[model samples]
Target: MLRKIYIILVHTIRVLAKKVGLLSLLESRRDRQSLLYVRSLFSIYDVDDMVQLDLPWWTFAAAAYVENFLRSKNGEANVFEYGPGASTVWLAKRARQVAFVEHDGDFAAVLRRLTEGVYNVSGVLIPPEINPRQALVAPSGRVGYENCDFENYVAAIRDAGGPFDMIVIDGRARNACLKEAVKHVKPNGIILFDNSRRERYRLAIEQVGFSPLRFPGLAPALPYLEETTILTRGGT
Candidate 1:
């Protein structure tokens, strides 16, 4: 009941922000630029329905930061992502190759449909080994899906054949994914970790020895502020 109320309250605030120009007052200059870039590409769609959106619903600052990195690469970087969503579609258009792993079959099928024509993208579905409905923190200190194991899901990126230039950890068992990400990403690779505001995620990220550049600001279709961190692998 409290979660529902929080959701409603946040939604109401976001709507108010949009209607009353509150975004301008709250956003920094960099955040405003990022929001503009997001609108330029995805102004027509609602991101609440992730399967329906054609662009990544990441925080405006993070999304724009990534778009710039991809552009700088000139479509030559190989990218891997843990969660496949509009980011898959967005990446397919920019990267040399895009591979991802998803735990949700229904969402994976929708993603497959969306990227069917894009030959640069491929993904494998590795559903939870046990209960998909329950939640429990696994023994490895990874939270979420307590009843199931994601050992295989976290390791599946290795099968994607990378040494990838970029990896986005935006799925379940993210701390575990971050550990695996360190192994597969190129020495100079970029790791995009969403929701870095979480303490557990921040703690895990720090232990991995990456230098993080955090973007804390608005995301597309979200009212409240959030954070997405871009970690440079092999940071001293």
Candidate 2:
């Protein structure tokens, strides 16, 4: 009971700090690294438009890392994302092909519109359904992976020409998505899981046996710090 209360208090404080601009002030005091990163994002996209549209872009640090890494790779590398949004635009700019699966039909339409002129991007909608009895449960008792339509979710991507060079698991049933991703990703490909600080996901990732490189820090447009982990087969 006390631990839960402490957690709630900490979250509330963070929210308050972000709302009052204290978080931004603190970040500035620490360094201009994050600020510079945000500026770089503006070179590729309009911040106001993205914020208004509510698209999911990686945190500033994560975005910079991914952008740099993808630029260094072959231009023909294909990418698959479990969730589609701003990251789709970001990936499309750097990769040869970008495909994403969204669980919301309305949002999928929005994604299509957003990427309309971008020839190499495609979005597929696979709405989720509830399942009461979960077959798998993590040690932390988080049941996100077991209560969704993950089989069809994975199938949609496979049908869309998978075996992608990069996969991002930032949407629903993430653990289940990761399970499927491992089978579909090219041997040298990488899997990026955002908000990886959650204990349940950490435990789930441990079972995957991939060497993880974690980036823990502030993200663009979000209030607090989070971790985005990069996992590759045999640490490639």
Candidate 3:
């Protein structure tokens, strides 16, 4: 299939980049370890086959960082994520409870199937409503949703009962999600914002009080470098 071929091509390019020393720019120990961990996973499974894996489909470096952070919480971390996928399973293994907010019904069913018997995990489905032409733009001003409004999708966390130890913003209308995330995360909690290199998202989070620590590197199944920023609320 076309998607499978694309995945192979991207994985080839990443291997080439690693060989040519482009990946050497990330010389930190943790960064190198993260890359190695992802490489180990790829050795056992195809790049396109990570959906069934227990790893988040994020930058390898960010995944490692989050793993360590979650481990430090002693199985007591309460996590809330905007998107649901492999991460829901991954977090449920480490955290006390993980509540993932999803906007698609079909995918929510798929996730529920994947998460069955994982009693500590729950899904909140808040589908995006169609909006009028003039109100097509998301609250964060991002366009191109074809009139989909994610206002309720972004605000669903408040109703999900959080002051969570960590909040992940990787779904639609991220700027609006980040603004709302600021209110729901515990004072010392962290926010994991995937693809933070986007200008609108970067600017929005920068304006918030959390200090950002960004990890840029290859991600599972994707071509080119991706950045995942972990922002800690309340203090430098």
Better of 2 and 3 by lDDT: 3
Question: Candidate 3 at 152: error in angstroms?
Answer: 0.8
Per-residue alpha-carbon lDDT of candidate 2 for residues 38-91, written as tens digits (9 for 90 to 100): 422322333334533333456656666676668768677799998876778767
Local accuracy by lDDT, each model? 0.76, 0.70, 0.76
Compare the candidates by TM-score and give the number of the best one.
3
Location of the lowest summed lDDT over 10 successive residues in candidate 2: 39-48
Clashing residue pairs in candidate 1 are: 136-146
Per-residue lDDT for 198 in model 1?
A: 82
Clashes of 2: 1
Give the deviation of candidate 2 from the true structure as CA RMSD: 6.8
Clashes of each: 1, 1, 0
What is the alpha-carbon lDDT of model 1 when measured against the actual structure?
0.76
- Over 4 Å off in model 1, which ranges? 1-54, 131-144, 234-236
In the range 38-119, model 1's lDDT, one tens digit per residue, is: 3323232333333334357677778878989888889999999998787888888889999999988988888788887889
Let me know the TM-score candidate 1 reaches against the reference structure: 0.76
Give the worst 10-residue stretch by lDDT in candidate 3.
40-49
Clashing pairs in 2: 60-220
